[model samples]
Target: MENASPPSILIVGLDRYGMRACVRLGLEITVVCGGRSWDDGQVAVSPEVRVLLVDDHTNPEAVLMALDRAGLTDRAFDAVYTTDENALVMVGILARHLGLPAVPPEVAVRFRDKAVQKREIRAAGLPTAGVRVVDDVHDVTGITELGFERAVLKPIAGAATRRTSVVTSVAELRACSAAYRAEGTAQRTFVLEEFINGEEWFADGVLFDGELLFCSLSRYGDPCLTAVDTARPLHYRLFDPVTEAWAYDRALPLVTAALEALGHRDGTFHMELFHDPATGALTFGECGARRGGGLTQELVHTKFNVDLAECAILVALGRRPQLDIKLRPEAVGGSHLLAGPGLLYDCPSATDVLALPGVEFVRMEWPVGGRTPQGGGTAQRVGQFMVVADSGERLQERFTAVWDWFDARVKVVPDGLKTRELRELQHVLRPEARFGDALWQ
Candidate 1:
């Protein structure tokens, strides 16, 4: 048979660092974007990357159809990289069907579905926060009977904290259920768990046939999902790895246990965990077999010289990636999602900020006249700024200066506001915690 066209990597999402990582790896890439930025064919990037404009409303089957039309599904590509936690299963199944490896399709659902993952992790005697899945609104009452002070209500298989809520009272729990029902969501899977209040950390690592190849811990002063306000255009400083430990001793064991329990034989593992400072309690939150969102992969690369997207691609292609994790002391990196009024306005001095010593990238999502809705998804970003510094404190200083500068520079000119009340509610509900200040000046 004639030799197939040069091996290509098909990346299914265009959110954060995945596309860049694939490109940096020098892999022939075809990016399938379901968002307008990808659909309008105005994505400003290298020409080597082929863009497949797909609609946001396109179903999973439709995505596969697009791939087939591109002749990619006919064994033209060597591997596929898919983001979006909930799409893990479908992407894996599709990739496998096309005769390619996809980070072990058997455990794809475990990453997105909390109930299934919790059960399997518990079965393996791994330390995991307690979870109760509710099939109906009435299940909230039973969940309350478990005697937990607070319960986290989240969709079983979803991302970006779409319906994730922390309920302290039975009323709030019932309200969460009502809200879910009001949306008419067919899959009413809800995970009610004991809230783990502590220092939050994220562990992203690669696994080769059940063996850990690389792992690093990302420390957060607050729970990541709770750190942002969806009621307003919100932005926050990214976590710096300077204070974080490269050797996640506690996490290493827990990860191994979780993987063994979930039967995840291959692929990258993105895990969120909580460590109680008072008691040194370590608990598993969730794990995904795919790359994480929030531009985390890029943060890791800039801080530690590790590329998770590249790792995912290499694993998918069955090629062992080089392992040279260069650790640097006092090195820091982070990104800020610029959120504000739904409508975009004149953004200030981004060029000047980009010129800063440690600054790496400045990306604005919405155009000067684009509308930015109050949201927690990737679309909510008005802009994003990334920077690196000598320490976490320096990083935060630069981040805050630039953020305040951006906020002052940008304002919605015409006000037909939609999320005004929601913004006020968030200020009331949101607590004041100094994120990224632990290692600050």
Candidate 2:
């Protein structure tokens, strides 16, 4: 007897990690990237894998034509998956067009639209923040009618906190809206939701057959908005027994309820929620139908031994994912090295970061001389690294020690202070308002 040929998968976007997962599963892969070269030399796949270049990865028609030109239209495919948010709807449409297994296109749209998602959750009787869809900054007046002291303004379909801001006063609201308009994004519908003040956390896991199979809750060291507003280093750790127990008791049920209501029957989900330290109440933030960003998938693997990337592909292929949901004794976390407003002159070597105690891996995105933009958004972060330890306390200790070492070694020369003369100009002016409240205002 001979082995059957591996199932073929068409991944609609450039997800190097997802591609690696397909290769690991021994599946034949066809990657369609959106007008970008696949130069990420991360993982090598079988020679059987194919790459199709397309002008627009988010256009289902364009993708289908490309697939047809690549001789894929006549072939049987097990699944169509995309890690890119913009490509989710495209994947869903492609799945239906190709008769592959996937969540419906409408469901994918629900995942992409924050206003729609909040409405669905509210309709399901699940707890969610009050959200108003505004066409422009001036429309935020409706949010004031909702009688909330503060609100969060963000694009209905945006990610990574891009164009996201917190507005307390009407003036701030208008200013934030003006900035978005200046960037030519004002015409797009945005959501202004009642701000939930509390500790921010996220739950990432796989759902199988309408049941939550595996979920890990992570606590952010600082609020995501704060991290973006201040250029502060971002840190998050997967729960150990104590924190896990707390989340399971307080937050997991809410997350499960929201997913059940959203018709998220199968696939990976990354959900953000808040826990009120004052009242112990849990409120829904937002969620996506994909793995969490940054080192989230890595933390899950390091802590629970579940490879979410691989499981995502398997679930998309209509196979029951085999995951180790049992929590491990060890703890895992990651810290992103955020670059301040400047010309990034130097940073500690990956080798040096890797040599730190309990360090698992280091991924540096900024080469020396790269310009670090003048903002606190996640896009401005220079690099990140993950660490694992035997216990939660040990993990925190290592994070502190490693970051202290990093702060001492990493250097960023202010954007204008490239020479001694420019450096003198800094002292002659009021301190530049590069980030934080000043930038947002």
Question: What would the per-residue lDDT of candidate 1 be over residues 1-441, giving only the tens digit for each residue?
Answer: 476465688777663456676667677888777765464443465687887767641257767777778776665678877766655777777677777788545678677678888888888877777887777753455655634787777777767666667778878888767766676766576677878787777777888767788776776533555555433322333343344433365567887777778877666777877877777778888888876665577666765778887777777777887877876564454555564555555565557668766678765555666765553543456656666767667766776676666665565544563577545444333436332325536
Candidate 2 stretches with Cα past 4 Å from truth are 1-4, 36-48, 137-147, 373-376, 417-441
Leading candidate by TM-score: 2
Model 2 whole-model lDDT (C-alpha atoms): 0.79
In model 1, which range of ten residues has the least summed lDDT?
229-238
Model 1: residues >4 Å from true position, as ranges? 1-4, 15-28, 35-37, 40-46, 49-51, 55-60, 68-73, 136-147, 180-187, 229-247, 377-379, 413-441
lDDT of each: 0.67, 0.79
**Candidate with best lDDT:** 2
Candidate 2 C-alpha lDDT tens digits along 335-435: 88765666677788888899989999888876677687543456567778998888778888888888788887677767554567565544433255332
What is candidate 2's CA lDDT for residue 271?
95
Candidate 1 contains a number of clashing pairs equal to: 4
Please give the distance, in angstroms, between residue 425's alpha carbon in candidate 1 and its true position after superposition: 23
- Candidate 2: residue 178 lDDT (0-100): 64
